[model samples]
Target: MTSRKEHALKRRDLAVNKLTSLGDRIIDDVAKQTVPAIRVPSRGTSNIVYDEDRRYYVLGDRYGQRSLGNVKQIKKIGQMVYMANFCKGLVQTGKTATLREMYYVSEGWDIDFGDQQESNIVGEDLEVTLGITREDLGLMPEEDGASVYGDITLKDDDVEINAMRMGKSGYTISPTIDEVELLDHNVERVIAVETMGMFHRMVQENAYKKFNTLIVGLKGQAARATRRFLKRVNEELGLPVYICNDGDPWGFHIAMVIISGSAKLAHVNHELATPNAKFLGVTASDIVNYDLPTDPLKDIDVLRLKELYKDPRYRDEFWKVEIKKMLKIGKKAEQQSFSKYGLEYVVDTYIPEKLDAL
Candidate 1:
């Protein structure tokens, strides 16, 4: 078996090769006294398509041209070159930078980025251009990754760590797991929760011990790192994943994104999407079934549900039925809605009932 270190090294070497090729192309164009142009893969929604075999959304074959011939695009080309050079330096040194750090780093460049959003796009351009992930290019996440708690053991570079020994706060999932090794697991299933509050409550209740499961807190719509880690847990650890979140339309979309992949990140869906993951989160029907307190749905929420009903990912009968039920009820509930009974209600009552049905 290839060790995790070897895998990371191979990825690093691939990134370096791509970066060098990009630089050579620009230099060759300059030496030939021609308008230097590069074809950047389109990251737009129009270029996103569902791959039935892969079971995820991926980028279609559409390219955008960045050329020095166009004065309007000169600045963009400049920014791309600078960003590529920076990433090359990072890969060469075996160092990593967060997107935020890249934004700040751009301030020192001759053609600096207008803002963080612009900086982020340039970084993404490199990934699509190279056919690799930002992580592969030595880019880290600007925000910290998600939180996880369970009866599991992981090794991060020479250190052996136990999830149980980490206490109630548990372990915060790192931005990349390329070098992290899963040594062993005492868990049976994986519960991926959206809110930190509910995740902490479950941990406080000894749900991991009681249920023999790993609990991951996604902290809203999961970032790429979190989704990738969940894929690892489901595939490598052989643990089934069930997402838990609010009963709102956004919550439903979050779960679907993990299962079917989102258009915004279609390029890296193969690394991030986990189609086998199930959405066991709240449903609008829960309002009537459990007599739970709920706030009236906003017009936006209704609009979103109508849109989801037409989304290819939500074509399943289970989603359509749930969307209609939510529309009929016109209300939504949070995961904490179970707390109306007691703090232990989620672990002792609600979760047990849901798991038994599964």
Candidate 2:
């Protein structure tokens, strides 16, 4: 296994190469008396292509927006240069920075971003331009999400944890998935739960042990580490992956991101997304079939569902039927709604039934 230092050094080299190329381009443009242009992938669905074979989305290099001559392009170039220098400094000093810290660092740049959103856009631009992730540049986002009751041992830096032996409440996953090594695990499948309430209930009920499975709590939208860890577990460990989320548009999106990758993080989709991961229940149909309690679909839920309905990735017949049913019913159900029969129903009945079907 490559040590953290070795990994960091490799990333540093890549960053250096990117900077050198940019500098060379600028020099060449100057020599030719022409505008210096940097091409970056456009950040949207239009620039993202789904790899049906891999079951993940990747950013296409076919079309790129050139940063050249215009005031906006000039400011963007300044931000890129600023970010490159900052990342270089981090690598040289063997230091790490948080996304928030990087945002603050932009305050000292020649170009005023006016807000954190503008600064974040430049950071994303660097990811696309450099073909590297923010994490590769030693920038960490706020840590959220965890795993519990997995028959797996993880070594993060000096800390080693046996996930299953952590009693009822399992270990909090490391913020940096790159830093964590899965020493061993004897599990058949990994179930990523979207809600913490359901996750906690499953752990409390020892659901993982009962089903010989691993449970990962996404909390809501998954963190980079959670997604990366899940991807590694699926790819390296060869575990069947499943996701359980609420029967709503947002929940569906969470599952989609886990399975096909998010457009925003398209550059690192291969490293983080598990395209083969199957979508397990708490589906729109589950509400009616299980007689689970339901809440009226909110305006936001309808809007999100409408958007998802239009997305090409969600055009499957099952998705179409589920979404159509949701729109027709105008209601959504949370995973916790299964608790109406008793919390044990989800672990004892629902999950097992889903596994049998799988």
Candidate 3:
């Protein structure tokens, strides 16, 4: 009598032969145009001997199953097999399946190995599950490739660009503003300005003339660069930095950059952006205090604000006041939306008032 191991191997071979035969027939049919098309198996087809629930085929020491490739990977591998089988059947109708077909059959062995999402350290197949690097799918060669680090070193100018790339889903860094240009050691106050022209004008007008008020331009590359430079400034100068972005989702995101750091660039949180940076202007509270126009607020914004308010990581008294103000206003008032009256209003009232309070 055959040993159980021997029986398993024989069954495995038989199943492989059956799959091989089925693949060959499907290809032949496709080649002959007998059927409109052959749809590749998705998930896994039940093996006759394994029954529906077992979901595995006999291998040397155990059962086997199919690799549930991600939808895209499944299609790619399936199409290749379909084409090969079609051509092979045409060339040699009854010949034994080629090594290519055998390889796919063996690839299916991963199924019988008992590796699944519950037991697996990594997701079932990160490549397939998350649709990330193909190697994560276990389809790529096992050999390790070159390290991710490159020989390229970043210059001062490249930091913003690199940070932007790194922070694709989050806020951009602000440009660097020399505190010395604003004031000398006698500087006492810091102001976070949003617009470049306004910032430049404020600087030119000597708005920050006496105080060390930082006139940050929270728009474009300047803001992004400023975010990065702020780290160095804080470390070197031992001065407190403040934030002043427009009042909008984008603006909120910018503040979040300084306050919490972008998801991918979180490592640079303490290094680039300052967490304690206060929002000095254009807050939800400014709606009533500055008396600005309002836009119809969407539920999404309200929900997002609520979430932000609840976030223990970023929740602060300043944020609480702003969020409550927005809840009271029931609308949004972006600084850019403000007309000349609003702009002047900000320069005249908002800036002056906040400066006094600060």
Candidate 4:
């Protein structure tokens, strides 16, 4: 029942167990496996601060105990000890002297030296393993949902139904229905809705059950990944995708992430590509037809639109037209702006109508 605070205080008061006494045997075992002749080095004359400042050794074990909780003092001593131990370990191990070699050698726990040599050795790979590898480790496994981490391998039989669409750069897919359930074995339509409000409204109106929609909110990289995955579905499974986003620069950017890849994650094109997918709602031209809010369009949005208009990579007629039209209107319209039409507008008018038009 002891709280963290109580446990920490008790630990501080208790006799310190040196690392050598606690787990030195483990390190010795590792050394024996790797280097059977390994031997502990004897103390020698050194210029290290701890070695030179003999006052601490003379002051007994309680030398730095007075300032135990002083963060700055503790950090300073930690840095000196770390650097000395690292150099000594390197010399003894005869490992490579290169930066990358050193990087891999001394990883996992971080050591800060007051400079900006920040390196995360056990980085995303560890995260991926922890999040995704656990499920696959067990011999007799149980059914787990598609989680971010753990080992859940995908098999052909697992995919009940698949659809695909091909476009200029690649392809994309529509969400498949779960065929395992006998009565509910029909193919589902995968709809990409940028706004969560719009998604919620669509769900309330039974858009998923009616059209079998998989409402994905595509903000930033998720949009790009969705697009890339859609493209793959299109190419591999011949599925067509419909995009529903606001009629603005950022929305267009989100759609483009599916159609072509975002600049930052362009390398992910292999997974998702809906090159043939069509943009179906709230275009720059729609501004002229519909009433737009007078709030001056974001300056940065205008700037990005101009960049898109000029960029050769985004030379699609649709992109050029929309970007130029936004520059002309000088206004941005959100999916919520069309809320006056009500949720029925999205379900009865937008969803069915858009797909029929497509």
- Of the candidates shown, which would achieve the greatest TM-score relative to the real structure? 1
Which sections of candidate 4 miss by over 4 Å? 1-185, 209-212, 219-229, 292-294
Cα lDDT computed for each candidate against the true fold:
0.87, 0.80, 0.44, 0.44
What digit string (tens of lDDT, one per residue) describes model 2 on residues 33-149? Answer: 998888877777777887777777788776565656877677778777778778877856657788788888877766667777877888888777878887777677767556666
What's the TM-score of each model vs. the native?
A: 0.94, 0.89, 0.45, 0.49
Q: What tens-digit string does per-residue lDDT give for candidate 4 at 1-358? A: 5533343334322212221222343356556774212122111222111212211111112111212245554543344234334433433332213333334444533665322242221221211212211111111112211101001112223342221111111122212111111112133445666765665665566665677544444443343224434554355445456677887777776766666543332222333445566676577666665574435678898888887787544676877777777888788787667666664766776567658765
User: What is the alpha-carbon lDDT for the whole of candidate 1?
Assistant: 0.87
For model 3 the local lDDT of residue 140 reads 21
- Which ranges in model 2 have alpha carbons more than 4 Å from their true place? 1-9, 27-35, 62-72, 165-168
Task: Kindly give the stretch of ten consecutive residues in candidate 4 with the minimal lDDT sum.
Answer: 132-141
Candidate 3 whole-model C-alpha lDDT, 0 to 1: 0.44
Off by over 4 Å in 1: 30-35
Candidate 3 on 1-358: residue-level lDDT in tens? 5433344345334434443654676567668866423332222223112212222221122222232234534443443344333333422332233223434443554332122322221221221222222211122222211110101112232232221123212122222121112112334434555555555445444455434354445553223345545544454556566666667555676666665554433222333456555666577767666567777678888887777777544455877877777776787776654454644555555566766787
Candidate 3 is scored at a TM of 0.45
Question: Which candidate model has the greater lDDT, 2 or 3?
Answer: 2
Error of 1 at 149 (Å): 0.8
